[model samples]
Target: MKKSIVIFGSTGNLTYKKLLPAIDNLIRQKRLKKDDRVYLLARHDISLKQYIEDAKKQVKEMLDWTVLEEVLEFVYFHLNQIEDYQKLNHRLKDSGYTDNVFYLALPPKLFPEVAKGISASGLVTKGDASKRIVFEKPFGENLESARTINRELWRYFDESQIYRIDHYLGKEMIQNILVVRFANRIFGQTWNHNTIRNIVIIAKETEGVMSRGNYYDKIGALKDMLQSHLLQMAALIGMTRPKTFQSEDIKDAKVKVLNDLKLDSSSVVFGQYNGYLDENKIADDSQTETFIFAKAHFMNDKWRGTPIYFITGKKLDEKRSEIIINFKDDTNLNQIFSNAKPNNTKLVFKVAPEDGVKFQLNVKQPGLSDEIISGHLDYCHTCNWVGNTTEAYEKLLFDVLNNNKTLFTRWDEIEVMWEIISEIQHMNIPLHVYDDFDHLKEIILTEKGVDIDAL
Candidate 1:
């Protein structure tokens, strides 16, 4: 079957940098057939030639323009205009393209209008999963808003046909979490409250909001990072093994973990960067958080009483995203060797800047006077296969093409996620100001008693 991808906001950064490049990659991989069409819809009145030229300049990779030109079609779209969608429908039909995938790369506010226009214009038949809609994140401002968005989307498209994308879920390491946990006997056996001391999820950025100052100031790190990416990573790390690896089962497990998450006002720490106030489009007295460190725990039996820490920030540290699982230090070693202080065994999953796994074990030091030291079994996933690894967007776009919802978030998971965020928001946690990463780390240790080194 020939596939047609109708991308709204096609001239946006995401479309040029991610979506189009992903489509180009799919074509290169022979995953997208020759007949596959990419319909670029934008509010701007730009010709196909001009759009292609702009794309060539912005897209980082050397694109096969011949292939892209063959598949590409630019349509002048007015987002709220019903007549425009009707014309778009006609264009698709006239070009003999069906089995459409609508990628809405627009702002969250425009989702409902675009969804309504698509449905009303007869672009998609009711209850047809083949005609899917993809939604970008900042799903909604809060729980109530998320509910409203979900309700509005459900009015036009069935739950199965809606793909709510959280790009973090598409990363190779994130996908590998399932295999690392469920497939490995060693990790699987000890992945519980008994063996694990605490789990730390950290996503740090060295750069502040660049061009997205307006958007970042409004959403903040808590909503932008914790609510979606960090929480989703936590679910993947903490969720019980699913009955099957199917989309529904995987989502069910994730939803269960999300539902069990507990956060309090006292457990949350919000921080704004030193110069965030001076950022373009930011308010002088903006209370928005550039950093968030929250101590959370699961209420379920498997992970009950286990401390799970989520820490994310901008302009404070080197760019890194990782999950660290610290196992309980061996207490019995002290009884055998009076001078022994065994380091806690650690399993680290490095997510960004690099993709890798590191397991730290206490081993006897050489020239042993009965000395113990930490030995690492590190596997650099990216180092082994440098350029061959699939980009997150590429993997996600391919999944959309294949109608695989395994990597995409389910509505129920989003609901539970918002509920967690809402709980934190209602707590009225005071936002602090931090000078740098070291200061932020100090604040966390002082307030929450969570040592960054230990994590």
Candidate 2:
């Protein structure tokens, strides 16, 4: 069976930085066989030779030269005017391919237009023949908008044919959260709120939105990071173990977990960097939030009373995405050591800048006296196997090619996510202005008791 990938907005940032490089990697790894064809669809008229030259300039440093050469041979350029589906269908049919995957790497506003064009053109694969469409998030600004988009997409594509990608789901450590919770006996035993006191999820960047102020100012950190990525991570870590690793089973658990999230006025915190107003294209009076710190709790018995803190922002002190699981400190040792109670065992899953796992434990120091000190059992994926860990886009793209939606977001999940966001938006929370990441941390700790000190 021959498959063709038609990528709209092929010259955009995502296509240049991630999509093409991932395709090149797939070819090098022999996952994307040579028989498959890649069509770069755009609104403008660009020669295939010129397009290839531009692509080469962007990805040459990251991709091997030979891999790029072989991958380029399978690539084709098309002047795709998605409004006319008949010509689009004719163009695809002429390419001599049946199975199709339409990847829209364009702005959210263009999704409906392209989808309608695909549907009206009737240029897709027939029943039971593999045809899929991939979309990136801001699934919609709010719940109502998300529902509308889902409805529009459903008109043309079946639920099975739609792929809503959340790249964070493809992170090595994010994928490992399930294994750590369900596969390991020790972690599995203490997975519930009874043993675990709380969980902290953090995604931070040191650089501000200097170049992307126009986009960042509109969406802010709440919608850009917390609503999709942080929420997804919290659901994965907090959800009950699925019946199996199958896509449906895992997705079912995630949806249920999200449905159990309780949001209130008191639990939400929003912030904007001090200089965010001064950024180009940003309004001085804009109330957009570049930082968010919220405490969310699960309504289910398995996670009752356990607070899951969500924190993320641009222009922070550090650049990292990690999950910190703090277990309840042991009281049994309080009688023996008097002042030295058993330390809280923390499980850390580092998701960015590197992939790794760290277990914080209390151990007796090497001395005549009984001095307890913190010890660590850590495994750094990048350190041990440098340049071997798969990029999030690489894993995600391969999953789309293989028609595996396990790491992808579903429509139902997106709807629930937007509902949660809408509730917070209606609360009219103030966006606190912070001078730096440390000041933001101080405010969080002082007000919410969320100690974001380095783990």
TM value for model 1: 0.96
- TM-score winner: 1
Assess the local accuracy of residue 42 in candidate 2 as a C-alpha lDDT between 0 and 100. 66
Please write out the lDDT profile of model 1 over residues 1-455, one tens digit for every residue.
Answer: 88989999998888988988888888998888889899999878999999999888889988899988998989988987899999988988887888889999988988999899999999987798789999999999999989999999999999889999899998989988888998888877789998898999999999999878877887999889999999999999999989899989999999998899987558788998888899899998899989999888998899978888888999976999999998886668678766554555889999988898998887778894677777899998878674667889999988898899899988999999988878678777787888888997888888878788767
lDDT value for candidate 1?
0.88
Report clash pairs, candidate 2.
none
Q: Tell me model 2's lDDT, rounded to 2 decimals.
A: 0.80
lDDT (CA) per prediction? 0.88, 0.80
Candidate 2, residues 1-455, lDDT tens digits: the string is: 76777788887778888888878777778777777777777655666777777777766446664545543432333334544557657766786666778888887877888777777678653243377889987787777878888899988888888989898998888998888888888877689888888889989898888667777777888889988999999899988888898999999999999999976558677888888888998977999999988888889999999888888888888899999998887657776655453535898999988788999887777879787777899988678675557778889888887888999998888988887778787778867899898888788788766576632
Against the true structure, whose lDDT is highest?
Answer: 1
